[model samples]
Target: MKYTPHAYQRYAAQFILDHPAAAIFLDCGLGKTVITLTAIRELLHDSFAVRRVLIIAPLRVARDTWPSEIRKWDHLSDLTYAVAVGNTAKRLAALRQKAEITIINRENVDWLVKNNTFDFDMIIIDELSAFKSHRTRRFKALMKVRPMVSRIVGLTGTPSSNGLMDLWAEFRLLDMGKRLGRFLTHYRERYFLPDKRNAQMVFTYKPRPGAEEKIYEAIGDITISMKSGDYLELPKCLTNVVRVEMNERERRIYERLKKDMAAEIAGKEIDAMNAAALSGKLLQMAAGAVYDGEGQAVRLHDRKLDALEDLVESANGRPVLIAYWFRHDLERIRKRFPGARELRQEADIADWNAGKISIGLIHPASAGHGLNLQDGGSMLIWFSLTWSLELNQQTNARLWRQGQKHTVTIHYLVMKDSIDESVMAALSRKDKVQEALMAAVKAELGKE
Candidate 1:
């Protein structure tokens, strides 16, 4: 458990300590948690400059990730921390407990800042991109406490998941509107020209001439961005698709349902709400079940379940993290594999890391952030594909991140000629857009 950082991690720690108001635009799998934790440990013990510290992160991350990381390492193990989560009583009780570091979920930011009188000297915002929207209540609440916070650090992998317009609010939280601007309207008007394309549905923000370069130069002093491929020796990640094929009977049912747009199953009339709804039902059918209007999950053929059984059998004893889409899929999966454990609460995370759980089931949205699962497994099977690029990438990063000794393998279970194909296509388009955006920003930063 002795601590030894990679060269980039060491540089990141120093960067955080040196700049009071800064943003670490680090890629996934990089050790941002330990880097910031090391900086905070030194600030408290060595310089005696910081006393009370606060970390705002995702729900599960706040409850488990930060505290777990502190205990995992020897040098930072002595730092005391408490999780300010759960019901009102639990949160208040956690706040009352004497601790050097208080970690709270992002949802409770407004409540904690508004109700408490404590003036924290150091504040760390993990996954800063969560507050990209200027209109969110969490960002507004944090703005009220900015004057009292002495030092602030923002950390995120996809800083501009959407576009440059998202950075206005995040950077404002770090520098008190110095680099960006005091108001989002002014910031957009100054640097971005409005696009009337899809005006009713989407108002695009086009960057002003040389605006990207200008923005990068302005924030250059406080921000230190690092790419994962540039520093760490990342293990190769291999991707594979497990296609599920239906038998003659199942294919007849699927084709009839698709052709008629309505099918009766289990004495209930299952009707599509719209095109999107029809696609959803097809997706559900692909996964072996469909839900009716009365909130009933009608059972279908078990093609996907058979695929899962084969996958689990082939893996032998290696732990496999399975990401399911609907409640019915999970139920069917559990029935198929009686030993599979649900990735629901913090307690399950400990057992998973200890290799006690062989087959783990989790929804992508639940395990998408801050949980370190590299020690447990190297393969991820997507029982269903998600449309959101952020969730898909973040969930995969859990197993593919640093500390894993094996080349990560990701397998997607896709039903041919179904909505699964559409979901994969959508993700590809989104990935290209985000990659281009990141590349453009990186190019501008390199000019400096």
Candidate 2:
């Protein structure tokens, strides 16, 4: 395979060369892995300070991504790499060997360090957002081994979705508590307020405060931010909301359940405590899983299935990518679209991109990172909604990426006034909510 670099790849390679201690905030499906691999190759070939590279990623990514990337690029073919996913003894044996690159899952990093395994010259932390919470034992373990590593790189699309506090832990991993301070409490006091009413801390920033810009610029000094839309002529995403009407059977069951549950607690004071439980049961029923009087799941509404069928028909023979959330969703999708394939059945994501399969059904959480599936389909339909902006954006990028030639259409099937609508709303503004809470705290303090 001849090595030909895309424009973004070249830019990323240069950025890596310029900043040895920088993070790469690249979007999903934008060839972040290839860019990182190319950088590793350049580092090794140019005889930089880095000789051995350790890649810490998610379990599925560690098992399939690192080695696959090394094999894809001709330049990286000469590099020797090992994936750590076996019995403890086998992993230890592999660690003893002299592989130029080693990939391990983030979950196992603490164990590896605790067992005194071999260290590497450079550490690449993929999905760096996974380490956003400083309270985790894994974060502490990684911090303990930070000094021994020569170069540290953090990679993620959502670095600070929750708040500026997310930056604290990731920056700590990179430079041992330099940028965001040593403790989260200290960082919060500097840029946020402790909300006694909510028992939570919130970031404080005004439109013209210049605090966010200053923090972003400070981080930019040590990181390269890249967006897929910047370099890729991705297809236009057309989103359609399909509202499904529940059949009489479903409505009757729902009403009966609501009445019984209401009677069970009638005049007993409805509060947030019971309302939340009631809401869960309603959501479950809305998703076609209604509990019978005997507390068993009875089929309620197949409107979701009807909506999916309509979407497939509208595809007009174009390949479609379906994003499913629950096992029930998956079961319904598979039954309706038996010809559809899944992304997990094969190890090679490129196969899907190469048009070897049609109608790929993928779980957003599982399919929302590292892999590229742009060439596979240009249409995506959400079988259900989830309250995760990260998963939503990542899953959509699978088709709406650099290589896509057609307009990418995203279809969101939502039942009106149901849990689907609320979930979608939550996902759409999750980031804004965090920012709003932060601003609210700042306002409350200002009033004081």
In terms of TM-score, which candidate is strongest?
A: 1
Kindly list the per-residue Cα lDDT of model 1 for residues 117-208, writing each as its tens digit: 76688899998988988788899999888888788999887776556777899998999899888998899888998775564654577889
Q: Estimated TM-score per prediction?
A: 0.83, 0.82
Candidate 1 C-alpha error for residue 398, in Å: 2.0
By lDDT, who's the top model here?
1
Off by over 4 Å in 2: 6-8, 194-210, 245-283, 290-296, 347-358, 431-448
lDDT tens per residue, model 2, 1-448: 6778776667766777677676777766667788888888878777666888989998778888778878877778888888877679877777877688988888888888898655687999998888988889889888888888878788877766655657778888887767767787776667664443433544343222445655665565677665656565566878788888776655665665565653222222221225556666666666665443444444566787887887888878877888877676677678777887878845446667777766888988888876567777788998777666777877887777777788888988887667777877766566674344223222111110
Off by over 4 Å in 1: 162-165, 180-199, 203-220, 245-267, 270-286, 345-347, 436-448
Query: How close to the true structure is residue 337 of candidate 1, measured as C-alpha lDDT?
Result: 90
